[model samples]
Target chain A: MSSHDHHHDHNHDHEHPRLSELQLRVKALESLLVDKGLVDPAALDVFIDTYETKVGPRNGAQVVAKAWADPKFKAALLADASAAIKSFGFEGRQGEHMVVLENTPKVHNMVVCTLCSCYPWPVLGLPPVWYKSAPYRARAVNDPRGVLADFGTELPGDIEIKVWDSTAELRYLVLPMRPAGTDHLSEDELADLITRNSMIGTEIVTFPAKAQEAAE
Target chain B: MNGAHDMGGMHGFGPVLQEKDEPWFHGEWEKKAFALTLACGGLGQWNIDISRHARENQPPAQYLDNSYYEQWLHGLEVLLVEAGLVTEDELKTGKANGKSNVAALPADRVFKALQQGSPYAREIAEAPAFKPGDKVRVKSMNPPGHTRAPQYVRGHVGEIVMHHGAHVFADASARGEHGVAHHIYNVAFTAEELWGADGQGGAVHLDLWEPYLERAR
Candidate 1:
């Protein structure tokens, strides 16, 4: 029964004064390092720069794309996800026990980590800031329909929405159904249709041709 | 000190302000500082001894000053410097240059890579000890350190829906600060089993580790 309260402000004046000393020490140490010139600030800068520009959920998207293209692969994916995923060559932390949930006309899947940020890092990379936020974790389980509405996803009442809680042992990634008008595309072309938001069950993969033709 | 997952009870920790649409790394230094303090306190003697007593004995305020990620960043910074990966000066320079030593990669690429092959491509191993449709009970016991199993769902019984390959264990106590072996599984449970009649209306499934479960009768 949760309703959207977009006006809610989570920040309040509950500041604790105890951390001032620690904050000062950190600032002082940072200043000392800058003065010493032993560190190259550019390295940290480049790291952030690279992540924003290059690293993200492309791997997850590729997995979804391959699943859509090959029926045998999709069957294998649903039957033995971890092994099927390995056939494509992805691996990393929290990805050992990979499970692929298909979003169909009757059933939709969404993933959340109520314990912590237990994500499939090998596929989805680091989770988005919002994924780890408290509001998302709480509302996702309590009022899933309302939460999905916030993300602009309106599910039909007849469709059963399954919200899966990711614990430490197993991690989840959603394989959203392929968008319409993508029947003739190749696997590589299909890969571009997937989005990170789709894998998280927030949005669907939209056809690029529709947008391109509309733009004209 | 409190557990790492006890973040919800902290003040000003309910939701984030939507209007503050700043860059992702806003207040980066503050976050790092918070993580360092928590790690020092949570890791206890192990961290302090390694740090040569650099961290003070007093714990910081529960959640008022910095967010959890900030604390995580801070902890990483301290550990990296301690491990001689980078220095305090290097961290500062990285910050000033708008870079982070540890930045996440693109989700799409990461997912693509994972699907390309098994993560442990170098070490080929045998299949898992269990299979689908097996009745298993999640292990019930509270260890003294970080665990992947949530307190609410411990000891619950579920069916083995899928068998994921080995990766890293989430039980930090057994695997040291960071776990080594991965004992992963997808366990499906009926809502009634977990929450009794209240949850009987629908089914609730879970993905758990092998160590977290035992063969259920």
Candidate 2:
């Protein structure tokens, strides 16, 4: 070992060199809370399990697909989102007050929580790291086109972009426009095309060439 | 409060880095942090607004430097200490000083509680001050406490596009006053209005409460 490297090992002999610093901190906090009866370890597991298994972007895909397949459902979703979403048993937490913004040929809708990472958990699930990151939060409202460029999303100049800053308790979901060539697909097949980003309004749903060929 | 968490228009953070097929929790610690925060929240010592304030009220340098879960952990620590559920020494030592009298959230109830998340909307007798399509101006005032109003929208004029019923006022709720409701509206501002000549060709909508706006004359 280099002499400089050896010099920095003076007090490191007893400490855990394997676990990262953050892991150690978390371990310490969890044990402390559990010991004092402030939190149950099982409850923690439930939280993790719930998000990992029961909830996610797939739920949002189902909603989007249903909207695309049924005009009545689409009207219901745009009119009273909370009730419509509740019908699918996706009601709670970050989704109490729901507003589904429909993307059309003229207007594109994007969602962001500039103040904090407020997201619609019931539908879209926990926010992706980029959504919570500072760059997305700071620029999504001001330089949205620039931000979209980062995601490789280029929109036509004539189409107006609408950025929704989730500054209150109300949560928003972007109902992306169904791709033109997707009419031949079933609701399940349509749901397969909906990505979390599309629901967040960062990307537009595009009919994959392979899928179009299969349809043909 | 005008903290770093209220970043809307200020720049130089760089392009967003998105993970390809990212997992729900990036690490083992993140899961714990998320769970601990939510579990403690069920203890009823503090409200969601207060917990948010705890995160946003941190030192600007540290607040911006920490990762998403790290920020949540820091806020959880602050809330625990202030709520008298845990102590600084206990955190450092990784040992509990004594068993807290507060009841821990039962594991079985976690699902139901999560499914029935706290609803902030409340019914108020008075009608909203403005309606859809009504022009309004965001009042310029800086309060040194928790506020949902982003700094970029302050002093700018916008038009109301939707009216959300009265909801619990976050500013007051952060100060421990519960049930205070205010009418909130989705105010739409042109990109040019918010950013001047440098603005992009688009619009920004903010869910602003009644107190933050006034009729545009």
Candidate 3:
């Protein structure tokens, strides 16, 4: 979703010491690896580029759009998410075991790794800094509605909020409800309307026209 | 090891540090740490679980103080030493004393390996203990080692909604041991059950292993 807003969190202010020492430790480890030739610098560069530039939230958006369009695919996705996602070549790493939670008009779904930053890497790529931050991890489970509100997503009191706590063994991906008045739009355009936060359950996917109307 | 990494339901780390335009890798060192960790992982010396334990098992004070990537770097060192890829002396001195046994990841293969990521699922013949729609209580034992069960869920009852065939148990897998496959389930817990009636009442769904639960009386 949005960056974890921590202005009101007073506990964090007194915790977490300086980091200059950690920087030196990382530097030492890298130098050792380079000297040993165990890790080629060029290869390391390729690794970083692959994750940062190649894999991303766009992959998850495509899956969501396809599910919205095809009922069969949606059933298959909810049945066995790992296989359905792997069919799209989004398999591996933090996403080994996936469970897709469908969001309906009565129920909303959100995800947070309470223990650690266990996110679906192949589909959503690496998690945003906020997903891994201390406050979001602690509060997402305790105050999901409040967390969603911070992201500017307000739901009716009647709709139930369902928060999923991700773990190393399994990862959760939220399939958000489709926005109305865009039945004629192509799948590509529908995918465009989906934001990373929408799939994370903090925000909902609204059509461009609707977003503009709300802005006005 | 009940380390700081277990943040569920704990208070006081302020709002998520939102970035308007957050660039990957806040600095070059973070990039190096990320790449190096991936490169070392490519050697097949350890599984993802081990890497997680290395990070999670850190001394509480150190774990809380370090940044995210800094934790990654710290975990990498633990793996290198435990896997015998490097010695503590080498890490401290930043020197390679002898010829290496582990082959470096070739640049050309880096992209391919990343694309063809390894899957952690394994085949298990034993039937699952609990079934969907069954009421169960999360085991309350305070394990001395790494665990996926959170502090809040232990002893609380929930309903099993789905079964994810079989996968490696992270508790054992984190020690570099595999084949301890167990059925995983999506257990649904009510908001009021987890944090009393004062909480914003709703539901919380968690992917829990069969071992973490017992039939609720």
Candidate 4:
């Protein structure tokens, strides 16, 4: 099955003619729930808006940047991730308990929920489709390097790839190492250098072009 | 339930497809599915563990065929029916037989509800069974209900790296009971220990609760 495409050739018992079967099913379910006073449609709107627009990896980037800029915060983040993260007002839902894995020269950390799509929703937002897909869930633990390679990341032979399988309530986020030649940049600029994948550990933070020039 | 959801270390699936700048919801239906699940969950009829079990309890063939959101939608339907809030006939007919007594989660409360998420960590009077640096084996048992222990580490020995205080036990929670509190730990397993010759030169860490573990023999 193609993980990217939602379209499948399942035999439908009934058809809407215009809408897909799944779409029609959801609409019917929603209408039924609303009619029964089981769920508020307005509340559903808020739920969608929260994840779709509000919370995302930018929150994680700022956390990483603060840790990079302030050693005290870094120590606190490493020590108690939940409280340190809550200082930024980004704790709730799937991210009640948190752990930050620091990637260093000797070790690279990657997070995966082998059982289901358990992610740090407060910091990193909802997991990307690839992270939740069967292939990733199956391979990440047994073949960390291979999974990294799929994400276009290749580490040195010596760097130990630590695969964190989030099997319980504690959520994990990778604190990617700051790239070289980024010391001159401000924390905000440093946050700009961090990508969603970087904090996810599939990609490493890299020196921006301006920072590279400034270093020289 | 040893189902398709326990996919770690398995094979035959294709490469991990990474979409550039992937959106939160792939389709409008997915958004509805996600929101509906969370909103219905707020009704307090079922816990997250029960919800998870609903998703994982599907037949392997059916579970593997459905998308992530498809699975969520399926699970939500199952929960609604099991809770007596809805019926299969009502779902098919697209009509509610009667109104629900539970108040719907209001729009204004959605933000606070999400921001202050339901925490699973529980206070237990008992001390942790094992300490850091202690070796333990994941018990090899196929539980008929919900469990957080993954299949790959099931019979493997690992060292406890850190002890996370007591948390809700998922297996008990799936049965709609207030879960039994168990001390959780971060167990570290070498790649070689998990996958014999196919093992990569790395390590895997899993957050395991007390019930899933025993002293390594």
Candidate 5:
């Protein structure tokens, strides 16, 4: 049978040897801890549950939202991104020397870690699967606009899109243009405007009203 | 061995795995591990001994079971704990205290400041090593580890279009052992020049590094 046929047949099924092995190891490790009385299985379960719900890109979204609302703050962000970002109390590994690129009418910005998926995790959280995917890493540098199109982002033909590849030395975070109709909104409301996908340049942030209208 | 980023032409094996759709805590430990590795390198305490051994002798199946990030985290933990930068107890305490101990700057503020052209003033002020009209060729070297020079671009000649100031080197093999300041360059190449007339684009631009180029004859 052809590969395409095989793929269609298994459309709903997926196999991950690595994940299975990991699950097995996790169980084994948990049992070991329980047997040694070092930790309780229930406690471990609680910890895992809390971590899953509480830890994520929401903090990054808040930072992106604040930048969208304040111009001087945006200026500070552009001038010394690392220090400015620190003012909000977010900092770290991939974030050591963070640089923020603004997407404007004249020019747009997209970031990629062409070498081994170097991303600003502390702010952006874990990169989307596509960010680390081989197709993205390879095509983004060569055909940025085309790739953006695939992601449902199509810039005006006149506008220029500058693709920035993050390296070990400096990391990048994209500041997407704030959607219109978001004025008069509170900081928390604005923070709600930001999405992790927007920060990564995959999707544009939409105002809730506009989004709701569209959905309707 | 191949560079870490060179995964092109290897797609047909299986379906794409969407990491977001997976359970939230699935890769939490793994992400911590990956950050620790980067932190160790940032703090100047990276040791490749274990990595080299792992790559050479190959660890047990259990070791391979964890995601790449998990392995990286374990490696970082081993190195940092051994070096006394962090103790296991401290790590646990920090975890209990809520959030990993790594420091971070706010994302939005950083973006705003950089847009105002105030952050990289000193670095930007320094004149570019090469100008827009200068002709340069990508350097030819088969160094181990990750490099910005895509295999297709090696030995190809291009012209400097713009000069982005000094940036960090992407080659982990070089920077992992010794600190080096690598600069980024915007080099433009005609499609015909790199891939002949059949190449789709009229001209291709590459943001290459200084070491990736030499003066074109």
Candidate 6:
């Protein structure tokens, strides 16, 4: 090893080589909380598991698929998203005030939180890493077309892009236009095709055949 | 406050790093941070608005440098200290120095707490200042405190889309006060209004509290 590299190692002999500064801080905080009898480490696992599996993008996908299958339910969802979403047992916290945005042929909708990471946790679970990233936050508002392009969602020039800035209390859920030739599909089958990105307006839900075509 | 968190219309943030098949949490620390914040938040000592202010009131450099959960951890620490639940020395030593005035959220109640999430909306006595379809201009005042108004939306005119019932004003709630209740509206601003003539062809809808707006002629 070079002499400078050896000296660099010597400069930080007190610090733990494996853990970063932030990681060490987190460990310290956890240790203190556990030591003080303030937190149960076991509960932490439960919290993570709940959001990770029990409630997630699948919940949102079901809401979208159900809306696609039932016109009356779609009307209710369009009229009052907060009430309709609660009917599915997805309510509270970030989703107390929900607004469903429908994307038609003439208008496309996209969602972004510019102020902070205000998302519909109950319906869509926790947001993706990119949804909360700095680049997406700034660019989503300034260049909606560019942000859509990054996701490989290229729309016709005449269709207007309606970007929803989730700046305040309300969280948006984008209902993408149903794919063609899927009229025979049931709600469960359609839910399987729905992705987290499609409900967020970054992409459109496609049939299994189209997905395969894109893959090829 | 016009903090780095108000990053609408700003530039130079670079491309978003998209991860394929990403997990819910990056590591153990993030999971702990999330649980601790929610658990402590269940204490009901301070509201969500106060917690948000704690994260936003950081120095620009520190705020930008922090990851999502790091920001949460940072804010949780400040709130814990400010609420007198834990001392700085206790935080540093990783041990309790003395008897704590606060109580921890019991493990059994974690699921109940998660299921019964805190709702921000509250009943208010006053009528909203504006109604739907009315044109209103966002007040252009920048305070050095917590505010929901983004820097880019200030002083711009937009049409009201819907009226959300009266709720707690965030600025007052951030300071641990009983903020006066007011109506919130979904203000629809055209991209051209917010970003000027060169702005893109689109519309940005925002849910703004009554205080942040004034009727436009």
Enumerate clash totals for all models, in the order shown: 51, 1, 6, 0, 29, 0
Query: DockQ, in order, for the candidates?
Result: 0.21, 0.43, 0.52, 0.52, 0.11, 0.35
lDDT of 3 by residue, B71-153 (tens): 88888988899888899899878888885788888899987787667666677889889889999999887887878888889
True contacts kept of 5: 0.06
By TM-score, the better pick of 1 and 4 is 4
TM-score of each: 0.63, 0.93, 0.91, 0.94, 0.63, 0.92
Off by over 4 Å in 5: A1-15, A24-56, A209-216, B1-4, B8-22, B27-128, B131-135, B156-176, B179-209
Q: Tens-digit lDDT track for model 1 on B17-61?
A: 332222334454544343233222222223322221121111445
Candidate 4 A-chain TM? 0.88
Task: Give the residue spans of candidate 4 off by over 4 A.
Answer: A1-19, A209-216
Cα lDDT tens digits, model 6, B1-217, are 9999989888898756566546688777778788788877877889888898999888999888777888899899999899888898888777778655566777788877876776667898787788888999999899998998888889999999888787778888887787566788888899899888868887888888898999997
In the order shown, the candidates' Cα RMSDs to the true structure are: 8.4, 7.8, 3.9, 5.3, 9.3, 7.4
lDDT of 2 by residue, B31-131 (tens): 99899999999999999999999999988998888888888988999999999899889988998988999999999999999889999889999899999
* Model 2 docking grade: acceptable
Please report, as a residue range, the 10-residue window in candidate 6 chain B with the lowest summed lDDT.
B14-23
TM-score winner between 5 and 6, please give it: 6
CA-RMSD of model 1: 8.4
The deviation in Å at residue B5 for candidate 3 is 1.3
Interface RMSD of each: 9.1, 6.1, 3.2, 4.1, 10.0, 5.8
Q: State how far residue B202 of model 3 sits from its true place (Å).
A: 1.7
Give the TM-score between model 3's chain B and the true chain B. 0.95
Deviation in Å, model 1, residue A38 alpha carbon? 10
Interface DockQ of candidate 5: 0.11
Question: Where in model 1 is the C-alpha error above 4 Å?
Answer: A1-43, A72-97, A157-160, A169-171, A184-193, A206-216, B1-24, B27-65, B77-130, B165-167, B172-183, B196-203
For model 6, give the interface RMSD.
5.8
